[model samples]
Structure formats: structure tokens, C-alpha cells
Target chain A: MDNQDEIRKIQLVNQLDQLETISRFLDELAEAWDLSIPFVMKLNLVLEEAFTNIVNYGYQDNETHEIVLVFEKQNERLLVSLIDDAMPYDPTIAPDPDINLSAEERKIGGLGIFFIRKMMDKVSYQRMGSNNVLKMEKVINP
Target chain B: MMNLNFTEVNNYKVVQIEGRIDTITAPDFESGIMNLMSDGVTKMIFDCTKLDYVSSSGLRVFLMAQKNISTNKGMLKVCCLQPSIKEIFDISGFSQIFTIEDSIEYASGS
Candidate 1:
């Protein structure tokens, strides 16, 4: 990675609209770097789900919060690290949606996270002090 | 961003949605379809050939449109789904409820 290409960061308000903006930013970045479409789509979906989850459910009082997203292209993959100041919650601990249930029978919610897990090559969640950090990476090839 | 073009083919109101139909765009989609319904254009086919992606919110709008059309004694058809978008639909079991076709011609034929 070049010194200038090590990392790029953006600060977003915890809101639904941020999902599209972030996805577009990542999409353009991926295309500029010649990343695969599948990889870009997977990363966009994961970020969309994660950020939306935070904006919709993470804050109990609906107060303003900031989410920092960092994009970096590593040796063989792209790494996106999201840091947010919100309540402590681990998405990985959430129960997997029962795929057996029909759409009508299944309860609403949780589907986004499930899709993210299926799409991303790697996902990690951690809470450090006041920041909830989510790091997801995907290999450029296969 | 999605470019939505509304037109008529064989007297059936067809909505062509290009680009990703995800959360941010689904609300606009729901309103657009509902506008068609208000105009007495219920028998519809959503031409999704250019729709490269969709999320659960997009599915919700589809369900809303389906219910509205079904109750109005009309029909809604879906055609030309890209594979990435189709996988989401298939995984969500939407394929069972939606009248999916390989092409607009095939869907309009019925």
C-alpha cells in the first residue's frame, strides 16, 4: 500500500441515509482500485446492515451519534473498519434467523445481519471503551 | 441511484427500475407503484432487468405492491432479475409469491 493509500476515513451521522452514501463511496473506491464487483457488493451490504442497525437500534434515547468508517486496501483484500459511539452491543451474539421459517411465518428483522454474514469473507466485532468497532474484510479474488 | 421509467406494454402498466433497489430507494419505489395504482393501472409488470441489487426493504415494497394489486382484482409480474438480486429473492422465498419470468416478453405473454 502506498503511504497515501493506507487508509481513508469518513464520518457519518447515525442515520438511514448514510447507508446509501457509504455504499456509493465504497463502490466507487472499489471500482477505482479494480476490485471485484462481488467483493464490493458484499462489503457494501455488510456496511449497510451494520450501520443501519446502529442507527435504528443501538442508541436507546435516539440521541445524535457519530460513526467513523475507514477503508483500506491490504495485500490481497480490502478492510473496512467502522467505529461508532453508541451503546455496547455485539451483533455476532444475536441469534441467527431461522431460515426454515417461511417469509410470512418468519418474524421481521435480523435478516440484514444474516445476509451480511453470508456475504462477507470475515467479520469481527469488539467494544473498546466508548467505541464499538466492527471490522470486516473480503479477499479480492475468489 | 435507480432510474425509474413508467410505461405501458400491451396495455399493462410496466415499471422499469434501473440500478439498486435497496433500503434508501424502496420508499420511493413504494410510492411510485402506488401512484400507478391510483391512476387505475393495477395490472403491472416490474421490469427488473437492470436492477443489479435489492435489499429486504425493497422486498417489503414488493410485498406491499403485491397485496395492493391482488386486493384490487389485478396482478403484478416480475421479470428479468439479475442473479445477485435473484439470490436474495430466492433465499427470502419471494420466488414462490412473485410471478418471475425470464424476460419481459415471457411475463407479458401470460
Candidate 2:
């Protein structure tokens, strides 16, 4: 909570159609901060994967919910925070598939989190105050 | 968020893709191509002129299509990919495996 750190926040409605807008917003933020190309691509993928899951799976019974995304930059690193009041489902608990499985034998789902874990430098999740909070960060420079 | 359109150009199956090709829509993409393949149409060209995004999943579908077409001795060409999607392809070394062209005419050989 330092005054020197920069923060950007956007509130998203829980719908599959809003995924693209969220990604575009993130891209604009990245450009404004002069984020590198590779870093931007990686961050864009993570945001799309996470938000899609939220829009598809979260609030299955409810028609609407609010998803808040916050972007902060510090020390050449970008930290993205996603807050949603959907059901309590932690991506980390999902089982990781055996990479050795052949294409035909492998299960279809659960690869999104695995890809996110590989692409992003750090990812963490928590449930606080009836909200699911996911925080991910990437270092654009050494 | 994939903006997709299909057209027949110069006797070639052309799929014009736009916007992002991420996890959610990658499966739809794979299915779309598979539907065409199942109909016994093999020679295809992907016109990516307006495509602005692609994830590894999207790349995976391309790899799968390459394999399918190779087994059948059919040609699968990609053309007019924008910088963002092309960057992903280049970084992942897909430029070597697929026949990518600057335009659909080049890919169609006409």
C-alpha cells in the first residue's frame, strides 16, 4: 500500500462475453506501463484463462456477479489480482494430468491451470470475506 | 473471443479467423476444422489476416491439424497471420513445421 506504486482496477460482470474486453483492458494497461511484448502475451494468456474459468464455472446458479481485476506494477514486476464472489473452487486443488499420457488417452480439461502455472512466475489463491482472490505476478526484467 | 468465418476461395477451404484464440475457443476451432476434415475436404487454407491473438492451445490445434493432413497427404496452409499470432508461432518454432504464407493466393498456389 505505498503511494509510489501504480494501481489500475476494473470491475467485470460475470459473463462469457466480457472475456475479450478484460483482455483488451489488460493490454492497454500493459502498453501504458511499457510492458515488454513477451511479458504482455504471457500476462494476456493468464488473464484470459483465469477469467474464462470464472465466467463459465463461477456462480452457476446465479445469473450475475461481479469480478474485480486489479493491476499493479512495482520493481519491474506486474501483479494481477482477481476478486470474485463465486463458489469456492481453488484451481490449485485440481489434479495435474500425467504429461506422459498419449493424446488419445489424456483427459481434456484441467490443462488451463497447468499452463498458467508454467507461464506465470508466481500464482496464489485465497478465500477471504466471501470472495475468491487469485494473485499472479510476472517479472519483465532482471 | 475468436471471430471466425469460412469461405471457399479458388477451390480451397478457407477459414478466416480474427480476435483472440485462447483456451475457451480453441476447442471450438479444433472442432470446426475437424468437421470439415470429416467431410473429406483436406486441402485447406487458414486466412489469419485479422487474427490478433493465439495461445498455446490454439497452436496445439494447428499442430494436430498438421498431423492429420500429413497422414492424408493433404496440404494445410496458414496465411496472413497478424504480428501477435505470428510472434507466438515464431517463438514456439511453428514457422518451421507449418506452411505459412503472406497471402491466401500464395497458400492456394494460384
Q: Which structure among the candidates has the greatest lDDT?
A: 1
lDDT of 1 by residue, A50-110 (tens): 8878887788876778899998877777788889988887877787766665434555467
Off by over 4 Å in 1: A1-4, A98-108, B38-42, B70-74
Candidate 2 structure quality by residue, lDDT tens digits, B49-100? 8777776667778778877877788888999987766765654556767789
DockQ of 2: 0.20
**lDDT of candidate 2 over A12-124, digit per residue (tens):** 89886686787678678766787866577777777777887887788768678989999888867878899999888787677764555433344436656665776678889
Tell me, per candidate, how large a share of the native contacts it keeps. Answer: 0.14, 0.06
Please report, as a residue range, the 10-residue window in candidate 2 chain B with the lowest summed lDDT.
B87-96
Model 2 spans with C-alpha error above 4 angstroms: A1-5, A100-102, B1-18, B23-35, B43-51, B56-110
For each candidate in turn, the TM-score is 0.84, 0.71
Q: How close is candidate 1 to the true structure, as a TM-score?
A: 0.84
TM-score of chain B of 1: 0.94
Model 1 per-residue lDDT tens digits across residues B27-102: 8888888888898887899999888777766777887787778778887899898877777777666787778988
Q: Each prediction's DockQ?
A: 0.34, 0.20
